[model samples]
Target: MIELGVLFGLLAAAVLALIFVLLRRGNGSTENADGLLVEQARRLQAHNDRVSYNAASVRSSSPTTTDHYRP
Candidate 1:
């Protein structure tokens, strides 16, 4: 029972150490967040523009009347 307790303590300490290391390494990645945001914004704008253009074309080509056999 003592050996099992020691093994569990060692495993818990190793896991905590690993988590601390990963958090420290992840702290340096905040510098590129602005660039990523700008890129994502540009992509969103382009997609919105394409959607608006398609919507306009569809609106212009659509029929205003309900009668399909008249035209």
Candidate 2:
């Protein structure tokens, strides 16, 4: 139908306009900053140690005992 042709032309024009708008706005962001990613990789590797730990472990410091508390 002639109506169908007109509809397709309108849809194609809208899509082309949207593509131009996006091209002008350009692309988006970076996931990491500079050497931070490299340092993080090193830290992650160091953290991969066999010791089992979770958030609670990170929050707690080592237990401290004085001579008076000797077993």
TM-score of 1: 0.39
The TM-score between candidate 2 and the true structure equals: 0.38
Model 2: per-residue lDDT, tens digit, 1-71? Answer: 99999999999999999999999988665566866788889888778752346443653544352344448
After best superposition, candidate 2 residue 1: deviation in angstroms? Answer: 0.9
**Candidate 1 Cα errors over 4 Å, as ranges:** 27-71
What is the TM-score of each predicted model, taking all chains together? 0.39, 0.38
Q: Give the worst 10-residue stretch by lDDT in candidate 1.
A: 60-69
Give residue 50's lDDT in candidate 2 (0 to 100).
Answer: 27
Q: Per-residue lDDT tens digits of candidate 1, residues 7-56?
A: 99999999999999998887455576898898899999999888778734
RMSD of 2: 12.8
- Which pairs clash inside model 2? none
User: How many clashes (backbone N, Cα, C below 3 Å) per candidate?
Assistant: 0, 0
Minimum summed lDDT over a 10-residue window in model 2 is located at 61-70
